[model samples]
Target: MRCDTLLLSAALASVATAGRSLQHVGRKADDSLAAMYNNVARNYASFSGHHDEPLHKRSQHQFLSNKTSSFAVNGTGIPDVDFDVGESYAGNLPITSDPKDPNQLFFWFFPSTNPDASKEIVIWLNGGPGCSSLEGLSQENGPFIWQYGTFLPVKNTWSWNKLSNIVYIEQPVGTGFAVGEPTATSEEDVAQQFLGFWKNFVDTFSLYDYKVYITGESYAGMYCPYIASAMIDENDPKYFNVSGMLMYDPVIGPNDIQGPIPTVAFVDYWTGLFPFNDSFVEDIHARDAKCGYTDYMNKYLSFPPAGPQPFILPGQDSDGVTSDECANIFNDVIYAAILVNPCFDIYQVATTCPLLWDVLGFPGTISYLPEGAEIYFDRADVKKAINAPSNVTWASCSDISVFVNDTDSSLVPSIHALPHVIDTTKNVIIAHGALDMVLLANGTILTIQNMTWGGKMGFQSPPVEPLYVPFHDDPVEGSIAGSGVMGTFHTERGLTYAGVALSGHMVPQYAPGVAYRQLEFLLGRIDSLDSVVPFTTDKNFTEQASEADLGEGNAPQGYASNWTAPASDTTTVKTSPAAKGIELSLASLAGVLLAVFYLA
Candidate 1:
C-alpha cells in the first residue's frame, strides 16, 4: 500500500496554529479545533446528519417500527425504567482570549463524576475534529439528551462517567459552545491550544494531579496523541500524569492517502460487501500487489459493480428512502427499536412518504430514540427537570472544513513518525470491524503491515484472536450473532500491545461494555497483581494489564530507526509478476476509456 505522509501534512496546513509550550498546557486559548469555528458558524439543526432533502425518507420497517414507538414504557425487556438524568452538576472553563476580542474566550464545561470514587479520570472526545463533544455527551455516548423541548435523562451501559470522572471538553476554539475566531496556521498551533485547554480543564476542575487517560475516535486521533505527548513532555508529575490512551477506530495518521493501504486494501473491502464482480477485486489485486493476504475480507468478495448502491439524497426519494434512512436502519435493526427519527426527520428533505410530512415537527414530539435504546447525554427527563432548552438545532452534516483542517495539520507528521512512537511504547493496538464499509478493517491491517515501526521491522503479522464473541443480538437465533471479530496484539518483545474486539469505526458507541472493559484491562484497573497478562490459546483464559507494566520503570524509550520508504508501485508487489502485468493492462485500458469519454 502507498503511504504518503506529506499529503496528509498538506491537508492539515490551512487550519494549523503554532505549537505552544507544554508548561502552559492548561492556559492557552484557541484549542478548540473545527472548520465550523472560523470561516462560519453553522446552525445546530444543520449539524446533525441530514442530506439536502426537503423531507426524510423512510423504510417500510421504519414506518412499521415508528408505529411501535413508545414514550410510556421504556422497552420490551427493560425493567423499572427510571428516566430522570439531569444536570445536578455544572461547571465552567476558560480559554485563551485576545485582549482585543473580549467575547472570544474559548472553552466550555461538561459535568463529570467518578461513580466508583476513583482518582482515575477519562476524557471522551467524539471525533469530527470539528464536532461537539457536548453532542457526544448528551446525544451519542453520554447520559442524556434534550427531548420534547426539554432536558431529559437517559442511562448508558458503557458510561465512562460511571467508572472514571469523565470530562467532555469542546475543543479547537470554534467547536461546540467554545466561541472564538479562527486564526490557527499550523498543526503545532492546534496542539499548543489543545494543551492549553487540558491545563485549564485540570486547573478549573481541580484534577491536575489525577491519573488521566485521553480517548476518542476519528479525527480526535489526530488531537489525542499530540496532546498526550505535550502533557507528558511538560514533565509536570501532577498535570502530566497521562498513564495510557485508548483510540477506537481513530483516524490517527495519513495512512489512507500516504500509505499503500488504500490502494491495496480498499479493493478487498469494497468487493467483500458490495455487489462488485469477483473478478474485479482479483483483477485489482493482481494489478496492485500491495493488497497482501486479504483472505480475512473474504465476505466482501463479489462480482463486478453491484449496480451502484442506492444514494440517500436530501429532499427527494429518488432512491425511495428518506434522509434518515441509514440511521433508521442502524437504530431499528441493530439496536432495540428506538426510532431516532423518521428517515425524513434527519435531513428535512422532501419525500413522497406521507409519514415524513406527518411526523415533521409533530407536537409533543421529543427526541426520538432507537428502540431498546437509552439516552446518554441530556435525557428527556433531565431536560424537563432542569428546564433546559429542548429544541437545540443539530447540523445536518459536519463542516467539511473541520475534517480537512484537522487532518491536514495533524496526520502528516504523526503518520510518518507513528511507527517509531508505537515501537517505543511497548503497546500499540489497532482494531477494526470487518463489516464496516466506511473505515474498512482490512485497510487498517494492510496499513499496519506495510508500516515500519521505529524504522525497524515492518508492523506485519496476522492478528491472533484468542477469543471470539457474537456481537449483535438476533431474535431468530435467540443470541448475539454477526461477524464481530477481535484482534489481540503481541509485540515482538512478548508484551501484549492490546486487544481489539468487534466494533465499527466508533467502537465505543457500538459496544461500550467491551470497549470500557478493555480499557480497564489495558490500564490495569482490574485486580491483577501480576504486571502482565501472558497470551494464551485457552478459550476460558482472561488477561489484564498491570500498572507496573505500564509504569515509567517498564516503559521503553526511543524506538528503533530502520524505516525505509516503499516503492512507488507498492500496490503491485503483493501478487505474482504475471498477475501484475494483467492489472497494468486493465488500469491502462480504463484510463484510456475515461480520457476518451470525459476529456474528448
Candidate 2:
C-alpha cells in the first residue's frame, strides 16, 4: 500500500514535529476541550469519556427492507462516547454473485444527511495498495474525525456525507478487516473482484440508478481508474453508473516520473525546509542532470504537450529502470534531512516533535500509538457495534504485501485509462497536496502535461486562478486563515486539476475544508471551484454573490504574490503559494517510504 507498506501507496522515513499548537474555536458546549489542547505535548492529555453530542436517528420509515436490515449497524456508541454514531451500514459482503463464495470485501456506508442521498453514493478510498479506507473515514472526511493531538473525536463540519451518501471500502483481499486469501496479482485482478463486491453491496441495499462518484487518495489513483474503466466497460447503469471521479495526491502517473524525475524541482522550490547542506543539494542537482531527469522534466513539463513523452532516461529501455543513483535522489534528500531533524516528517514536512498517538496506529509514514491507546477499529466493542467481524485484526496499513513481488503491471492512468475516464465522465478531478513529500505536485503537473485528453495534450494555461472557499462556522478546524485563497485549480474540457497548497498526502486529513470544496465541485453541487458562501447549493448560490466575492476587498484572482490577506483571518484565509517558512515539500514525488526500501 504505502512504500513502507511494501512500496505501494505512500510510505516513508519517520520524522517528528514540534512548535506551534493548533487551536479550535467551538461553542460553549465544547469550551472545556478548547483549553485541554493548548499545544502538542510530549505526554498524552487526559480526555473526558463523556460526550454530549446528539445521536442521529432514523426519521420515520426504514430506509432498508427486512432482507437488508440484517446489515444495519448499531448506531455504535463507542465505549468512550455516550452518543451513538450516525445511521450507517457496515460489514463484509460476498465479492461474487454466489452467496457461498468465501471471498468477501469489507465496507462501511453512511447515507447522506440530505433527503436525496438515495440517488448518490460517493466512494472514499486510501492509497496503500492495501491501505484501509477507514482511515479516511475516522481521520479525514468522514462525519467524525479524531485528528492527531486532539483529546477527543469531534464531528467534522465539512464531512463529505453532509452532501452525498458516502461509502468507505477496505479493498483488495487481506486489507484491514477484509478476509480471504490474497490472490490477486494485478490491478485487473483487483478491479474485477471489486466489481463483484460492488454488485453485491448495491443489491443488498436494493440500490440502482444511483449516481456513483469514485473518490480516493494515494494508490487509489491506481485502483479508481481501473475500476472506473471497468465500470464504464460494464455498460450497465444499474450496477456501474459512475458519474464522476476524484483522486487526491494519487499515483496515476509512472511512479518514476511522479517521484524521482521531479525531485530536484520539489527540493529547490521548497529549499528552505530541507536541512541538507549545499554540498548535498549540489550533489542531487548534478545527479539529476547526469541521470537525464533534468532534461526529461524541462522537456515534458510544458504546455502544448511535448509530443507524447516516453521513458527518456538514459538506458531506461535497455535496463527497464533508471540508474540507481538517479532513483536514489529522492531517498537521499529525505534520509539526510531526517538525520538533522529526526522529527522531520515527509508527509507534512511542517511537523517536528513528539508524534501524537494515532487512532489508526499508522500516523504519517510510521505506525505509532501511545500506551493504552486502543485502535478504534480494532476495539472489540467497536467492532461489535459497527457490524464488523470481530475475528479479523485491523491495521491502517496492511502488514502483508497485497500483491506478488509487490508488482502491478496495469498501465499508469496517464498512459491510457486516466484520459479515457476523463473523456467519458467529463467530470474528473485530480487534486494534489503541495505539502506532500511522497508524490510531488509538480510531478503530477508533468504527467498532465504529457497526457492527451479531449483532443488536447495539456492545459494551455497555468492555474494562476485562485480557488475560493466560503467562510464557515467550523469549530474544530475553524475557517482557513487569510482571504480563503486555499488553493489553485484549473478546468480544461472534463478534467480539473487542483493544487492544494497547505495539504499533504492525505488532503482531507491535512486540509479538510479544501477537500470538502473539491467534493462540492465534483458532485456538481457548485458550478465552479470559485464560489463565495458559508455553504452554497443551487438553491442559494448567485452569480452576483460570486461577483461580489471577487471584489477588490478580496485578494486578487491570481497567485500568492498578488494576495494581500493576512495569513490567519478567521473569515477567509490564504494557503496557496505558501508564505515564508510555510513549507510545502513539493509533493511526495518519491513517496517517503521508498527510502526504506531502496536506500535504507
Choose the strongest candidate by lDDT: 2
For all candidates in order, the CA lDDT equals 0.35, 0.68
Per-residue accuracy of model 2 over 226-282 as CA lDDT, tens digit each: 899889999999999988899988877765767777777777767777768888888
Q: Pick the TM-score winner.
A: 2
Global Cα lDDT for candidate 1: 0.35
- Model 2 has an lDDT value of 0.68
* Candidate 1 TM-score, C-alpha based: 0.51
**What TM-score does each of the candidates earn?**
0.51, 0.82
Error of 2 at 255 (Å): 1.7
Q: Per-residue CA lDDT of candidate 1, range 189-237, in tens?
A: 6666666656655654466577766666555655566666666667785
Once model 1 is optimally superposed onto the true structure by TM-score, how far is the C-alpha of residue 495 displaced, in angstroms? 8.4
